[model samples]
Target chain A: MPILEVKNLNVSFKTIDGVVQAVNNVSFNVEHGEVLGIVGESGSGKSQSVLAIMGLLASNATVTGSIKFLGQELVGVNTKALNKVRGNKLSIIFQDPMTSLNPYLTIKSQMTEVLMLHKGMSKHDAVIESIRMLDFVGIPEAKERIGLYPHEFSGGMRQRVMIAMALLCRPELLIADEPTTALDVTVQAQILKILRDLQTEFKMSIILITHDMGVVANACDRVNVMYAGQLMESGSLDNIFYEPQHPYTQALLASIPSLEHEVERLATIPGEPPNLLALPDGCVFQGRCHKVHQECKGGDVVVQDFGAGRFMKCNLMQNLTNGINQGITSNVVVN
Target chain B: MEKLLEIKDLKVYFELKRSLLGKKRIVYAVDNVSFDVYKGETLGIVGESGCGKSTLARSLVGLNDITDGNVVFLGKDNLAKADSKRWHALRQEIQFIFQDPVASLNPRMTVAEIIAEPLNVYYPKMKDEEVLAKVLDMMHLVGLSDNQINRYPQEFSGGQCQRIGIARALVLNPKLIICDESVSALDVSIKAQIINLLKDLQKKLSLTVIFISHDLSVVKHICDRVLVMYLGNIMELATKEVIYKNHHHPYTQALLAAVPSANPKVEKHKHVKPLEGELPSPLHPPQGCVFSTRCPLADDGCKSARPELRYMDDGALVACFKA
Candidate 1:
């Protein structure tokens, strides 16, 4: 069974301008102990979709469709129950660790509170677990550092503290949102390594959300390409990086500046993402897609199973499916 | 070599008076920095935060009064002999494109008025129609439509606001542009678009650009030459090819190693040896290499004497004793 399953999830927010459909019929699942990456731009609704699954959306958010945690419904869960779900079964690590932690609380108190509450451990037991979690996440001098406040640690160290605090309750699934975006490159590597090491040590699933393709390429097992509040594509890392089928994914991959690339010039997607309130009637990426066609418009999304559980959410697949049905080889032009 | 701007022996010091001792401490914001901006090429000045890259850019535009050294522009001594009257006339030749467009642009001014500010100051008696036409033409060139000519800076996204900033800078037909972290605030895809636009405009207008940023990947994409700065001193300056291929400086090598490799199957050095010591206090640097305090290769000679920038193996200049 999948660790987390989300199906037909749509989230909308009531704003002054209009109701913005921030997430549109998003469906995906994470297997036990799998690392799933969600990549998208600033307004792509990748964060909110997961936020909804965690029951963390604000008062103005209107959520639809189903989100299940091990076959348990989560759409209309109560706050008290959701709090139980958090820190014990599910946990989140934000990009900025400073804000996630309380300033007044010492590191020991902040980390132990979750364990004391969820695991029902004694105060002394919680204290031992807090320091152990710190050491597990590679914090130096855990005893001395555990007594220090969150402000005492450096940026990278503080992020490690946040990860330790999140994992202290031994959550089955951890959601990390751009956890390394604020860090320098070398620090980013260290943090990604620690995350990888801990994911294996703790044996938990992770939902990694970030705009950086490079970070996801290094850490993710499977990838979901989100664009304009919808899933543009989903596949393995090799499939997304080496053979991206979606036009948006293609543009994103092509834009990575690497030493291997000869052409100094980059191929950029021409237009900004469609506004959530004013999304196009066709494919979400059709406006910026170079190979957009007339038949790519206004339909319930067409999904073609590529076998072995791989699927493509593209209009070109419709024609390819028909051609294959006629026993003819199907080839689609791609740049 | 026909260089556009040649900075030599540039040193900037901030005098801070202590309250207890009443003693002055000189903060070496920029010290002994020298380089040149060549004609019709992009020179990327890259470094980590607090490396004095921004200070160097502001110093180039005369926004910051230099404590010492020269910012010779087009063969003229910018320090000793650049008369105030000439700065006014030459102001049109050197323009600044800021990183945050929303903050850089005046929100009260319309797009036309913003673009025309340069012309209004430079050409006082020009016809209003001609100024409007120029503003509209610039707007069109930067991909803005005539319909949004009356919009303010706050009405557009960060990318659009940046385009307006570019348009405003280009209104005076400046030969050189100082892009101080221009694309740093933008997204990845937007950054690519802006880089492409800048490259296109650079070629079409035959403009010279000094692009200052800490992002090495972006700098690699946009620059013909790259200069790595540390604590207000040039650690490495070489062509993009040499900087990436035959990298000489130890600091430059460390910086290149810092970028995360996109491939996962290959175990790229997971254990990063980040610069060991904290950035040495810019105030009262050691008598030798600025990096010597953190350098594992620092020797007794390095502590006693400073090394001058000399030609290394690949025609690049380095200051370390080992080099």
Candidate 2:
């Protein structure tokens, strides 16, 4: 079994404007010590899906389906029960360290408190462990800097503190949501290198959620593309980049401004991300998909397993597969 | 092409007054930057936060007061010394697109009014119908449909709002447009759209642009000439090809190597010389080269004497003693 599995997960919120289906029937699994990337644009429900699995959604949200961690279901679990699993066996590092970190608390207090609460370590032991973790994350003078408040540290240093705190329990799974989005590229590269090193050293699985394809290519082992609350395609990093089958994934890959490849014009998807409150009846990406066909608008799009842990929820892929199997030759290729 | 704007020894310093007994400090936001922007060309200014790229761009439009410098636009050094009326006229000739489209625009104004405000200000004697026609034309040009002219900024998505910002900036038919992180807040697809739109408009209107961004790939995509800034100083200035492929300064090379490329082969296989440490405080920068603190090739010579911008063998201007 995988370390973490999310099956047919759906997250919706009750608002004054009516029900907003933020995440719909999205499913993916992370193996032991694997790095999984959830790539999406804004309002694509990538963040919300992971937030639902952690039970960190707001009170108005309604989450269903299965979010299993080590074969244990997380959905419908009480907050008290979920809290025990959250900071112990699993932890999350958010995008903005300044906002996620408590400004009123010192770095030592915040780092030690997690250990004291989750591991039941003594105050002295927790403080020592906090310093060790900080040192491991390459923060110089961790012993003295532990007393400093979050505001005293730079953006990169604060992110290091957050990472150290997240790894205090050595959780089996770590959810890093856009950890380096607010940082400069040089700092982002440093942080990503630290994360990669820590992932290997601790042998922990990571769920990296980001909007940048460059980040996904740099850090992730497996990648899944999300569009308008649905998973369009997912596969190994190599397959996702070099052999993307879904039209949305292909378009997203082509749209990224690459340093190595200079194209005169980027391949842009014509329409904006769909409004979740009024999503279309069929595939979520149908409105913007360039290869969208009649079948995409008529039925529920189902995930087709393409073997070797690859899957796609695109009608064009299915049609192409069928056409190839039936010996119908065409100049058009899906990728 | 003729030089559209020439900046010589530009410096913008902020006076930070502490308590009554505490000493006053001067933050050199932009320090001794000199460059020439050619007519109808896009010049990219790239750097990390607090690196003075934005300050340099803002100084050109008179948004930030220059401590000491010469800003000559169209053979006139009056942008800084201009009075209210003259500055107003200059504002009509130069416009800006901010990073945050939602915050940059007034919340109360509709799209039409926001685009028409520039027309009304510059051409006060023009009829309302003429202003409306120009606003509609700009909106259409930026890809906003006719229906969106009445909508407020809050109703549009980030991409659409940026389009509205572009429309407003272009409504005046400005000669030079300063885009300060214009597409940084947007998604990749939307960012591409905005970039393409800017390039299209630049060609159509023959506009000189000063584009400021931290994303090097975006800068590489849109800019004709790129300037790499560090600690309020121009580390290197070169064409996009030279900067991307043949960077000389250690700071510029480190910055180029630091950008995570979308290609997995390059990102995974290539050896990245990661830059060490964050930017030092501009209040008390290093005595010598501002980047010597984090530069990998820094020696005692680099730590003792600063380098001046000079032409290198690669046809790029670099400011590094080692280079």
Against the true two-chain complex, what DockQ does each candidate achieve?
0.46, 0.81
For candidate 2, write residues B20-127 as lDDT tens digits.
Answer: 889888999999989899999999999999999988888778888888878888888556566667778888788999999889889899999999998887789999
Model 2: which docking level applies?
Answer: high
Candidate 1 reference-contact recovery = 0.40
Model 1 misplaced stretches (Cα beyond 4 Å): A121-128, A135-142, A147-152, A318-335, B14-27, B79-90, B263-307
Clashing pairs in 1: none
- TM-score, B chain alone, candidates in order: 0.94, 0.97
Model 2 ranges with Cα > 4 A deviation: A318-335, B19-21
Worst 10 residues of 1 chain A by lDDT: A326-335
What DockQ results for candidate 2?
0.81
Q: Estimate each model's TM-score.
A: 0.90, 0.97
Worst 10 residues of 1 chain B by lDDT: B263-272
For A128-212, candidate 1 gives per-residue lDDT tens digits of 9899989887788998889998888878889999999988888899999999888766567678888888889889999999988
